[model samples]
Structures are given as structure tokens and as C-alpha cells.
Target: MTQALSQTRTGGPALPQERRLVTDIPGPRSTELLARKKAAVADGVGTTLPVFVEAAGGGVIVDADGNSLIDLGSGIAVVSVGNAAPGVVRAVTEQVAAFTHTCFMVTPYAGYVEVCEALAELTPGDHAKKSALFNSGAEAVENAVKIARVATGRDAVGVFDHAYHGRTNLTMAMTAKNMPYKNGFGPFASEIYRAPMSYPFRDGLSGEEAAARAIDHLDKQVGVANLACIAIEPILGEGGFIEPAPGFLPALAAWAKDNGVLFIADEIQSGFCRTGAWFAVDDEGVIPDLVTTAKGIAGGLPLAGVTGRAEIMDSVHVGGLGGTYGGNPVACAAALGSIAEMKEHRLDARALEIGTLIRGRLEKLAAEHAVIADIRGRGAMQAIELCAPGTKDPDAARAAAVSAYCHKSGVVTLTCGTWGNVFRFLPPLVISDALLEEAFDVVAEAFAATA
Candidate 1:
């Protein structure tokens, strides 16, 4: 019998939890759409899956060709609370009915204030905090830098190797990757310096040692007095889901504090219970002076925020901050709804359960397969790096083959990493054990056939 999943929500569809393939991977309709897309859409905008999505909820995404594929990417960790969630749909519907855009800068609304209040309450610190919302993670990050500079009267910003901040010019400079992100886009903003990051599997350095090395580099290279802030992702997202060794973040935070440099945690991908905590910095009791959030903030809406200590955030003049659509009322409503779903469902605990389940399956696969190099990340945000058998050399081709196999087999998966050799798994917190297990069964098959 086909697995019968629970209904999504009041207005949400009752999607089947099981993966089903009615036709080959992209089918005919998707192929036709692809041709249209190629003719119309820019070549730079790429699609991971050739098929177009018609519906998504619970643990599956139904494609235009009527094939239900198990969702493992969660729209790159944007739909952590699940797609078409009840609260999100209800909130957006009601907000759109009332009014669309008032230009919060000219005329503010309650929803924006509520979201800022919620951000103050949820983000890591207990101290008084304030937030400024924007449209994307890059905006949040860029604004964080602005706030840091204004507060400290410094020029240089510090970032680590293998970090992915965003694509905006300022953040593009902060991001560590070259190709696809920074290549041919030079003449980037100045005064951004890069330091070493702690990669346990490859660097083999303890967290303390790595932090010391990085701190020394910063002091010598940038000079503490000239540095404004040190921004880092608690767990790297696109540059591989690389988790720094234990003690690394706390040490960095301490150094920044003692040196009067701000610590910024770019939690764009790891916040909102995606990492078994409200924010990944919460795991080690390391509170950042500023946090940039976006991806999972508003039930997939286009909303981002930079939350920080009141004094730091208020350093700017009254009219110094805000944009035309910084905090759209509709987006704020969606944020409130998303937060409600996350809190009500206790998705943090759910993420932990997901981490345990997926880790067990990946561990078994790694033991049986030599190409499975390392398993890392926390909560539902886990990944497995692929490498040459018995060696740490990255095998991007093998990773591509395995990902292609999964896509062909009715599973929606995504591969990331600086070398493009890590298979990232960011399933919605609402995913069922049965569906996850089934997805991994296909992954195991991919390894057996392609690896």
C-alpha cells in the first residue's frame, strides 16, 4: 500500500508522502518548459532539477509532470517549517487582503514592529536588541557591516576562509569562494580580509589552536584597532556544511570582545531552528553582537534582518537606516506565522531527531562505501563529503554522478561545497521518518550504482 501521510493543513493539500515517478526524470512537459526557459530566462539563472514544481508540502514536491519527489534540499533550507504551511498561508492571505505595501519607511505598521520584537526575543542574547529588515540575506549582511563600522569607527572587516555570505557587492567581497560567486566580479569593496577557518577533517587542528592561529593572523594582518568586526557562519552553508571544531566560535567571540571588535554571526542559513537551535550560535552559548538572518525567517518570503545590541544598532542617525520596502507588512506577517509554526511544532527538537536519523543512515552508508569521506553538520542540516577512495582528494565528478542519479530516481537533492564534492541534506523539519528513510534508500542505491 502507498504510504498515507497526514494532511498538510486546513488549506494545504494532502500530498502523498511516498515518492512516485509516473515518467522519466524531466518527462516531456518539463523538457518543453526547459526549452522555453532557455529562450526566455537568462543563462546565468540555473535550475537544479529540470522539472517545474507544481505543489509542495510535508515531505514531497510534486513536479509539473505529476511525479512526487522526496524533498531533501528544502529549497536550500528556506522552507524549514514546511512548504505551504498552515500559518504561512493564512497569514499571507489575510495580510494581502488587508493591504499590500505601505512603504514602512513612510508609514510603519504593527507587523514590522512585532517581527522586530520577536527577533529580539528569539536571537541568542538576553540584552536589549533591535533589528532592521530587508529583502535578502545579502542586504542584512551589508547592513551589519554598516552598523559595525558606524559603532566602532573602524575600516577593515574580517572573515574566514570557506565562508559564503551573499552575492551583493559588499558581501561578495566577504564571501570566500571565487568562481560562480566572485569570479569576473572583481573591483569588490575594499578593506575585507580573510583568515583561516577550522576544518576538522582536513585541517586536523583543534578549535583552540585554529582560533589562536586565526586571531594571530588578524592581529598582524589587519590590526585590531583598524578592524570593525569579524563575521563568520557558525556552520558554513555553501562552502560545505563545515562545522568548526568545538571551542572555535567561543574563542573567536572572546577575542573580538576583548579587542573591542564586534562579532557578527551570519546565520542566514543556520538560523530559525534549522540547526536544532533558534540560532547555531546558541549551541555554544556564544552570542554575536550582530546576526544577519534571511533564508528561513519568513516561511520562504523575501525577508531578511540584521539584529544587534541596541547601542550598536542605534549608532546610526535616525534617517540613516531603512529602505523603501525594508519591512514589507506582508513579509512581516509571514515572519510571524513562520515563527509561530516553528515554536508550536517545537521544530528545534524535531531537527535534533532528524539529525540523529539522517546521521545513522549516512554513517551506515559511509561504513559500506569508501568514497563517503566525512559526515558533518548539526540538526537537520547535515552533509556528506565525497572524495577519492582512501584519500581526502575531492571527487566532484563522482558527487555529480551520485546527485544526477538521485535526481533521476525521484528524489530532490542538492550538492554544495567549495569543491562541489559535498552532498548537502536540508530536509524540512516536518519530514516523516518513512520518507527520509526511503530517500536514503535511493541514496544508498546511488552510491552502489555510481560511486
Candidate 2:
């Protein structure tokens, strides 16, 4: 018997939690909008799916053509509390009515201070902490580097292989993938160095060994004295939900601490109960000097933050870190509401339930499909890497085919990886178990059809 799951709890704009295809995948309305987008929008701004969304809530996104699709990607992990979550909607509505932006620099507000307090309480650290808000993950990352540089008085920044930081010049240098994020963007910021990551599936190395490899590279390429920080995603997001080997992070963090280098955890995609924890680094108890967050931070509002030790955060000059829209009053309210929702509903625990169900289904699919090279991740941030049947040779073609199949069937799935052979699932934490199981069935069918 199929086990029944509870309904999604998004209180506002309740959408029927079912996948419905009224027209073709890209329906006539979507096709028409695509033509307009091509004419009005820049060719550089690419979209994963061309289907224009009219409304979304709970576990689904409703397109302009009246098709309801299961949301597996969560808008790249932005709307984890669900689109139009009641708390977020109410908070945003009230905040907008009261005031929009006061340029926190010119005039401060309680919302910004309240958010910082929340961050200090939620992030993995018991010590004194402070935060500075920004508008995007890229800006937060850039600012974190600035804080690290000033605090440590070092110039070189170290990152790892298969990392995706951001699109800005410095973060592009920090990022590892080259084709889309860094093709023509040349002469990136200097003093940015890359090291090998702890990819057990590919490297076949133990966590300690992987840490040694990265440390050796950093020691040889960028000396500890010159290194300001070692920034990394606890679970690589666009690099394919790759979780570093068990001991890799701890070893690296220890080395960084010993050498006076700051450890920066870029939890932009993996934070906020998406990984069954407030922050992914909590799994290993690796406390970082600085943590950069966005995506799920403000329940879809444009807000990001850098939370770190008070001394390190305060080292920068008073005027050094303030943006016109940084810590916008409305975004801060949404963040507060989002945090309240996470705690009130215990979405962290929900993430674990979601992960167990997803991992179980994907494991069953892997048993039947030889192309599934690996299944790995924590909580709702899971992925299946596609590869040649018997060996680990990445098969980007198969990944693309499976993704195309899911899209055609009205399931919004996403593909990622440095090799482009990973099919990732980032379902909203509020998604129903039944919906997840149904989506997994579609994924299984996609794999079988491709096979």
C-alpha cells in the first residue's frame, strides 16, 4: 500500500498539490512569452525552464497556461518555506505598508538588528557574533572576503575544485566552472587560488588524504602567511550537491585555524534547514570564522548576510559595509518571518524526513538503473550522478535527457555538476511525501526511458 503524506502547510495562495499539464510542456502562452523574452531580455540571462509562472505555493508552481507542476528545485533553493508562505506574505505585506527602505546606513531599523540577532542565534556558534546584510550571495561573498582580508591582513584567497561562488569578477575567480560562469570574463581579481576538493566518488581518497592534498596545494601555491581565507561550500551546489568526504572539512578547518587563516563557509545554497540543519557545517560541528548566506535567507526576498565572530565582523571601518538596499526593511521582516516559520514548524526535522524518502526512492531507482553512478547529499539537498554503466565516466547526455523527460512530464527538475552529469533535487521542505514519491516515480520513468 502507498503511504499517505500530510498536505503542504503554506497558508496563503493555496495551490493544489498535484501535477497537471493542460497544454504541452511549454504551452502556447509560454511560447508567446518566450518570444517576448527573447526580444526584451538580454540573451545572456538564461533560464532553466521557459514556462512562465503565474502563481506558486505549497508544493507546486502554476504556469501561465494553467499547468500545475511539482516544484523540485525550489527556485534554486530560494523558497524553501514555500512560495507565498503565510508568515512571509503577512510580514512582507505589513512591512511594505509601514515602510519600504530607509537605507539602514543613513537611518537604522529594528528589523536589521533583529535579523542579526537571529543569525547569531541560529548559525553554528555560541560565541559573540555580528552580521552585515547585503543584497545577493555574490555581494555577501565579496564582502566576506573583504572582512577576512582586513581581519587577517592577508591578500590571497583559497577556494576548492568544482566550486560555484558567484558571477562577480572576484567570485568568478573563486568559482571553478569555466564555461558559463567565466568564459569571457577575463583577468579576474588577482590573488585567488584554487585547490583540489574532497570528491570521494571521483578521487577515491580518504577524507584526511583529500584534506592533505588541498593543504599541500595551498601551502605550495599560496603560503599560509599570504592567505586571508579558505572559502568553500560545505555541500557543493551547482558543482552537483557534492558533499565533501567525512573528515575533509574538519581537517581543513583545523589547518586554517592553526595557520591564522579564516575559514569561510559559503552556505548560500545549503543553509536554512534545507540540509536538515540550520547550517550544513553543523553536521561536522565545524564552526567557521565567517558564513555567507542567501537564497533561502529571506523566503524569496532579496537579502543576504555575512555572519561571523564579532571581532572579525567589527574589524572593518564603520563606513566600509553599508549598501543602499542592504538589509531592506521589507526583506528583514520576511527573513524574521521565515525564521519563525522554520522554528515553529521545525522544518529542519521535516528536511530529514524529506531526505529519507528521497534517498530511499533514489536508491531504488539506482538499483534498477546502471547509469546512476552515485546518490549522495544531506536532507532535501540530494543528487544522483549519471555516468557510464560500469565506470564513473560522466554522461552529461544522459543527465540532459533525464532532465528533459522530467520537464516534458511536468516535473521541474534541475541538472548540475562540473561535468554536467548530475540530476539534483532541492524540493521545498514543506513538500508532501506523496508529492515527493510521485516526483520520484517520474524520475524513475525518465531514467528507464533514457536507458
Candidate 3:
């Protein structure tokens, strides 16, 4: 282990610098801020906790009331490199001083091309690739669908149940959850079909069985020939951090190629070293025809991209794929800096290290807690699914209570899954071992309180 890691593992030096809580969590100032926020901010923007952050660095969030909370969620995994990482801060600062946006399409810039080159080189597969930048993961996904359809001359797009693409009309149609994302937000984009995902926690299906079931459904219903893209999350994100069975993705990719369908990997949440790999598809060596990325791409800036086989990406006309802010130079510079940081700091290895620690702790917890139905995921994108002891019925109440308890106890976490039973931990890859240990302690306390 490096000296920094060694320092982090010990509570001596790391605690004073990395975590310092001076007030109760969600203290007086935070409560006041929450009241002001409720008056000013839209009600649609709901918060899991009412705490207001005044600053963040390393792996901890400093709230307005001087309470420092361990940030296990990392702003929904958008800050993989850590909050206010030196490289990212420097790049964003310099880029903003130079010029924020000139619209890459109208006034081309070097930063945009540099980011694309980095993505083309880093993403999985050895195939020649082309990339198009976008403003969000949803836009990248939407554009990937357009490119695939244009390339293959097919109208129907196939998605899996429990998949979460985005909030756009089309992506909401692509998403499986209905409450906040898709309930009143229809009528969505059409010709989008959903097949069942292989969720071992619930479906209990093997890779082959799941693939066969999905293929069977497609054959009997949508007919493969009509499909232009088969969009899947290499690791199901909101559907409970389930890694598809070993051969599941490769088999599906082969089927897509054989049937003239484009395999689109929505790697928005699982990419950029968050999964201990450059891309989640690397686990199986599955080369997707198109891949959508965002979240951690710019180390928290709003930037996303779709990189794929050159021919498929080239099918769209020049005017077909870009938006005004699609590759803003500042965002591009941040992306380049974030990629450099990932390489220099070796965040992928850090993710694995963190995952090893979290898995060990969560497994120990699961062994003791009957409500912890399963503990799963890879690298730093791990989760613990709560259930009603031996029953498959989701223990969402327990999950929510656990989250509530964690928040009050000075730890931050997030929940996912169609049933809201999965508690996902997306700590920044740069998090200190001491802080992670503290967060784990908070979670243990929460579990004990809730259980």
C-alpha cells in the first residue's frame, strides 16, 4: 500500500484532515437552508436528505452547519475522482478563464477533439471507433439510438425491464420504473420494446436461461429484424447493481450481430473506472456497437458521449447528432483532466480496493442480518438488497429507515432498485480508508437500529 493509503487506514492523521464534524448532522444552518431552498427551489427536485453542503473535499461533505459527513454516494457516482479533485479543479478553473463555451460545432476547439480521442482510446474493444459528445447521458443514449437506426434502417429499439436510461420522453419509455420517472410523463417515444432482465436476486435465472427467455420474447413479440438497437446497461444501474450472469452479455451481443441489431451499452453509471475497469463491458470482453457514457465523464460536469464502431457512428448526417452545448470546451477540458486524473491516480485500482473493503463489511453484516437478502456488485459500485428475511418481498421500509438513520448518524448513502430495496454505495474512488471505515460504521449502526 502507498504511504497515503497507509495514513488513511490509520485513524490518527486521516481523521483530522478528512473528517471533522463540529455540529449535529443537518444542524441549525442546514435546517434554515433547507427551509430557504424549499421556498426557492422547485418541488420537483426532491432531496433524500435535507442537509445543505457548504463544501466538499476528499471523501467528505462539509455541511452549512460545520458538520462533516462521509459521502458514500458521491453525488450519485458523478464524482468518482472525488469532490474538488486538484486536477479537475485546475482544469475547470483554467478552462473557464480561457472561455466557457463557443459552441464546438460553430466554433471548433481543441479540447473537444482531445476529449473524444481520450474516450476512443480508453473505452473497451480494439475496433476502430468514432465518438460524438452530448450534454447528458440521456442525450447520448437518445443519439445512440438514432445512430443505430440510421445505420441499420430499423425502427424498433429493444430495452430490458428494470433498465434506467434517463428522464427524457424517449429514455423514460426506455426506463422500467414508473413512479417519479415515467408515471405522468407519457406518451413517450414509440417503437421501444422491453424484455425481462436477468435479476438473480428476484428472477433466479441463469445466464443461458435469461438469454433464452429474452430471445424467445423478442422472437415471438418484436421480431428481431425490426429492431435497430438493443440497449442494455452492462451492469443494471437502478435495477439493483446486478451484474448480468457471466455469459449473458456476450451471448446477447452475438445474437444482436446475427440478427442485424446494434448492441448499445448504456454505461453511464458503470463506466469511467467506477467498476474497476475502463468500462463494465470489459468483464466479458463484450464489444458493444455503441456505448453511452456520462456521470463521471467530466468529474461532475454535465458532459456525456456515445462512442462506437466508426461505420455506425458515421451513418448520421453532420447536422443530425449535436446540440449547442454538446461538447462545450470547458466541459471537454474537465473531461480530459478527469481522464488524466483517473490514469495518474489509478482510480480503477482504488475502486477495487474500496469494493474489497465494502464487500467484506457488508457480507459480515448480511451474515448477521436476516433482512439483508443479498450483497452484490463489482468494484466500488456495490449494493445490499434488503428483503423480508427469507421472503423475496422487498423490505423498502427497512431500506428507507436505514437511509434515514445513516443520514442522522453522519453518513450519506443512496437507494435504487424497482422496489427501492437496494442500498447502493458509490463512494468516490479517492475516498480515504478511514472515512470509508467510518461510513461503514455508520451503516452498521443504521442497520442495527432498523433491524
lDDT of 1 by residue, 1-451 (tens): 1133324531355576779999899988888899999999999888898998888888888888999999999899999877888899899999999999999888889999999999999999899999999999999999999999999999899999999999999999999999889999889999999999999999999999999999999999999999999999999999999999999999999999999999999999999999999999999999999999998999889999999999999998888888898989999999999999999888899899899999999999999999999999999999999999889999999999999999999999999999999999999888888889999999999999985
Q: Show the colliding residue pairs in model 2.
A: none
Query: Which pairs clash inside model 1?
Result: none
Overall local distance difference test of candidate 1: 0.92
lDDT of 1 at 432: 86
lDDT string, candidate 2, 241-308, tens digits: 99999999999999999999999999999999999999999999999999999999899999999999
Enumerate clash totals for all models, in the order shown.
Answer: 0, 0, 0
Q: Evaluate residue 353 in candidate 3 and report its C-alpha lDDT on the 0 to 100 scale.
A: 94
What is the lDDT, from 0 to 100, of the residue 389 in candidate 2? 93
lDDT accuracy of residue 69 in candidate 2: 91
CA lDDT of 288 in candidate 2?
Answer: 98
Question: What lDDT would each prediction earn against the true structure?
Answer: 0.92, 0.93, 0.87
**Candidate 1, which segments miss by more than 4 Å at Cα?**
1-6, 9-13
lDDT (Cα, tens digit) per residue for candidate 3, span 359-436: 999998998899999888999999999999989899999999999999887888899999999999998888877778
